[model samples]
Target: MKGVLRFGKVVKLSPRYIGPFEIVERIGKVAYILALPATYIVHNVFHVSSLRKFISKDPSKIITEDVNLQSDLTYVEELDRILEFSVKQLKSRDIPFVKVL
Candidate 1:
């Protein structure tokens, strides 16, 4: 995963899976080394429980954008579009909120 090792953050907003990297070699029964990109500073070896199989419906649908990371291992997230917008009314105020993609 992208920020799997990052601590003191909200779990729900964290990265689920970063890549579908190729397996380089198997270390033991449950450990395997992956061929990750050079930009990633994490350890190549990982436990089998942390990995997930990638299922692709269409190859052309996959987005291959290059994410530029900062020195702190964070990237700027840009807003694509607003999916929804709504206003909540209270006794004395109205709160506006947006659901974005």
Candidate 2:
């Protein structure tokens, strides 16, 4: 079955399982961009960076943060900005060719 992948439709994916975990689908431009928050939970808490490698054969395609330093905070702060940016882009809903990268 087909599904709606947008900020508004995120609710639908919140309570369901996708792959090894439950996730809400989010369509960015061309392909379905996995929800970052959900992805973070699985990535950080569960320790599965394999998804990054799976998404992009070239390491450059995979987005990352610089937490290698001596900072002890939490999740990558950049993800917050990314989600905010993603929401804005989706809301305008005008440019279909805009790339988040």
Error at 59, model 1, angstroms: 6.6
Error of 1 at 68 (Å): 2.9
- Which candidate has the highest lDDT of all? 1
lDDT of each: 0.74, 0.33
C-alpha RMSD values across all candidates:
3.9, 14.5
Q: Over the stretch 8-74, how does candidate 2's per-residue lDDT look in tens digits?
A: 2345434222223223453443333344443232322222322332444675555543222212212
Instruction: List, residue by residue over 17-96, the lDDT tens digit for candidate 1.
Output: 66667799999899999887777666789899988987789966776455565666666689999999999999999999
Which 10-residue window of candidate 1 scores lowest in summed lDDT? Answer: 1-10
Q: Can you tell me which runs of candidate 2 are displaced by over 4 Å? A: 1-11, 15-44, 47-53, 65-101
Backbone clash tally (model 2): 0
Q: What is the lDDT of candidate 2?
A: 0.33
